[model samples]
Target: MELSPRGVNMKRAFIVPAIMVLFFSGCGKDKNEGGKTSPPQAKSESAAKSGGEKAQMPSRLQQAVKEGRISEEQARQIMARRAGGGDKPLVRLGTAARGEIRTHLVLNGTVEPERSVDVYARLSAYVQEVVREEGNRVREKDILARLDDTEIRISHQQAKIQLEQARLTLEEEKNNHQRNQELKENELISDMDFQASEARYRQSRLEFENKTENFKNLELQLNYTRIRAPVSGFVTQRLIEVGDRVTANQHVYTVEDFSPLLIRVFVPAADINKLQAGMNAEISSDTLPGRTFTGHIKLINPRIDVQSGTVKVTIEVNDSSLTLKPGMFVEVNIVTRSREDALVIPRTAVLYQRDQVLVFRFREGKAVAAPVSVGVTEDDRVEIVEGLEEGDTIIIQGAEMLKDGVEVSVLK
Candidate 1:
């Protein structure tokens, strides 16, 4: 029913239809804009092409990548970076800031590769030829030696002849069996004759299989005539030479990677925990005094040296000088603990009164005698590890005159 327009109830029917039409039309728009509304993210573009779910990044990130402002990998790296608790970063104060407490173990160490192998013989024969000597550089799969292959060659030839003979015999037996069957069907040959021919054919097939297997065995044996280096390295030892008779599974040479020699230093159980794989290390040897080789911890042994109460921490060094030799004694320095924006003051600012620790904090351009907490100590600085903050000037050159409310000026 229709009512007068002046009444509020008169417009109800028109408002209801208008809202319903708009809602249904919006639904259609959303449904039709699936792929257009959600463009794939950089990482997911390839995935999307392979029929995977599409991902969308904010328009800013997409634009940044498209406009060459940032690479896709850089964007991914930024996204992967931890928020660091979304807290303010601490800036360094002086050239010598945060006392990087280095828990260095200046003890004995050795050098070796994280990966090494020993050359071993896999077949039994005399060393017919040797191409590489000790301390010589060898490439992987290079022929190190060759065994006396005469026996193997002879065996291979014998196998080939036997196989050929077996083939001919099998063929002859097949023809004999076929002929016997034809003759018996025509009543010219007895059943006994046909059975004998079938038996011969079966026997020949068995002999052929045996010869084929022997031939394959001989082929495999022939392949073992030459001994090749399993890996590229410097041969450290040579155990066999030409005319030397060696058995299978014998160690013939010891090779090692010397490009970046690996050295291991036994770290105390207590100190080992301070280091991890890939931690930077500075190593030195008495053989190379005043020279420090930079490297990183390659491995840390799980088992502790029970006798020494230490664990063997392996180190790989890029000491291109060939200075850090395996079995050479070495001293190591490893950075263990570090902190950012740590409060620090001059070492001379603190006085150790026997068992007590004291420091003079500056306030209002004057010194205020303040007892302070301390941490790691370095060559010229002591970490306040507790007290000061950014821009808190301290007396570096004069600390003995520092006292409560004593006015002072920062040195220019």
Candidate 2:
């Protein structure tokens, strides 16, 4: 301990090499003790074989948790996701209910009044008074607007005076002709003078008839100053106002009958045979949601359009509440066929594969595909004619990746 610095360094080096050699020798002795390998080495080989056998299973999930590769909760989740546990396709189910179903053709068209009349002015005159404005309800012959009748009335009065004067002159001529005839028959005057008097009386009679017709013409012209509604409906348009001059046959107002509206839809020629003049139709509008108006086929055009290959069909709507109006674009569903008390299901539940129609029926928490024969299809519903019964639960969603006997979790 008290040696020089060089002597102390040499002694420490010799003791460090001897200690390392003894440590290595002891490790070798433990590895081959009693002609057997160490316990840790044997355990590692056994684990490798066991891991290969259960690699695809969750048997090693707990070992992964112990090794800090995963959490304890994650290990439980992995085990739970195996077969005979919570692993299943999530799906929504719908019941096949017995109800009315129909086959229809959908089309879009503009709403028009059953009877839309354009009120026209018969005489050219300046509008004097506006009796009814737009949106005013009117009946047949209701005055919509009044025109200036000053000139017409004055002419009417003058014609009346002329008619009266002609009537007086005609009466005098008749008396004179009678007197002249008596004289001519009795030979109390010359033949030429009597003939001349007869001519004068005939001319006066002709003048009176002309004046009577002229007076009636003027009276009719005076009545034409008032523009009247031609039909009973709501006034939809007012083209004339106070001091607006309107001519003969000029459009002044538009009256539309909303009690029963009209919708003209052009249907394809292929579907023309299925339609008739009295088929039931359901009408709906985007502007008015959740409301359905009823109607029927009023007429179907016999001629088909050569260019478009579509036939024109007119629908007459029965809207007692006046909820529908003219010019509203609406969707029309013309029912071609219907079935009552038929088993129907959501259309999305059906799967079309080749020529067969299939649906996934939920039974015993599994998806079972069944072939179905469908009939009339209306909107999002289809009639189940075969292979399904009422009150059966079928998969409505999340069945795209499902196979036969595959487990499912039905959603509420």
Candidate 3:
């Protein structure tokens, strides 16, 4: 308790320094704790803000729904998987099934009548009467037109008169020759007279034959004045009219048979080998929408066109309705290859990377890349020859965004 001034001063200084040091140390600890705690609070606020933004932003499925491109049910299913917030990727799946696949060779073609005939005038004369006009249905031997037969009729009559006269002369010569033969046998006629009589009979018989031939020729010419249909068909064109002067062998009418229509197509040389006579084909035209005509290959040209690098093919269509007309442009689809009971998958599931053909198959909720051998492709399905089995599920849509072993949530 009794101390000197120097000692009091020294004690005071030590106590003040210790108190200040304790105060500063407490403040530093409080600052450090606040720093540590405030950061977590700030991080929590930032995380909450980020989550709110993500919820407000539209997902791929939501966007599709807004665009009217997808149904609400489909969009809902897609969004449901995304809302789960997992590592799984959303994908559309299709099942590999047994089906039929057919490959076709498509080409442009033209329609024509199966049978066409050009009727011609057989006699040189004026057209006296036209019984049938264009678009008239005619049968075989049906008279389509008639020619003026005045000159031909007169010639025929003259031939008949000459033939009758020759017949009478032949008969008289035969009777004379018979009497002469009797006289000669009784030694009442000379040998010269008998020879003359025989010569007269032979000449008369030859004359008769010549006249008969002339009469037949004239009769044929007279028949030719009447124009007849060579075939049973509809008259497509008529170039002759009543009182029109026509010459022999001139085209008078054009007749066509349209019961079975013909379609001609030029096929590329590369696909010609796949075609044959009697192969089934489907034909369609833009002019006649929603109509499909069934036909079969009728002919195949053995020679290939060097300039166009194509081969001519003829197809016959049964057009009983007569809806198809000649010169109509049409499209033809010929089945080149076909397979039944084939393991098939959607064409969209196939992926081409470099030289490999791969498909993303679903196995245990993961996408597994499988290399597949492809065969005939028909419509939206492709024949899987290898690396896939029936009933296996494969990714159809959203396959391009997937890789092997990635988790996938399949949408029905």
Candidate with top TM-score is 3
Candidate 1 residue-wise lDDT, 123-201, digit = tens: 8898888888887888888887788889899989999999999999999999998888889889998888788889999
Clashes of 2: 0
The lDDT for every candidate, in the order shown, is: 0.71, 0.86, 0.88
lDDT of 2 by residue, 1-412 (tens): 4999999999999999999999998777535557766788787777766765564634555555575544665554454444335667666789999999978899999998878788889989999999998989899999988899999999999999999999999899889889988998999988998888888899999999999999999899888987888889899999887988889998888998887889999999999999999998899998999999889999999999999999999999978788888889999998888799999998878888899999899999899999999988887898999999889999976566789889887654
Candidates sorted on lDDT, descending: 3, 2, 1
Per lDDT, the best of the predicted structures is 3
TM of each candidate vs. truth: 0.58, 0.73, 0.75
Error of 1 at 15 (Å): 99
Question: Model 3 clash pairs?
Answer: none
Could you tell me how far off, in angstroms, the CA of residue 213 lies in candidate 1 after the best superposition? 3.7
Question: How well does candidate 2 score on lDDT at residue 246?
Answer: 86
Model 3 agreement with the true structure over 1-412: per-residue lDDT tens digits: 8989999999999999999999997676423454743456676777766764466435765665676545677765665555556566667888999988899999888999879999998878998999898889899999999899999999999999999999999999999999999999999999999999999999999999999999999999999998998988899998987889999899998989887889889998998999989999999999999999899999999999999999999999998787888989999999988898899998878998999899998888899999999999987789999999899988987787798999988666
* RMSD (Å) of each candidate, 1 decimal: 29.4, 12.0, 13.7
lDDT of 2: 0.86
Please list the residue runs of candidate 1 whose C-alpha ends up more than 4 Å from where it truly belongs after superposition: 1-107, 122-126, 171-191, 247-250, 257-261, 288-295, 303-305, 316-325, 345-350, 359-370, 387-412
Error of 3 at 312 (Å): 2.1
Which ten-residue region of model 3 has the weakest summed lDDT? 29-38
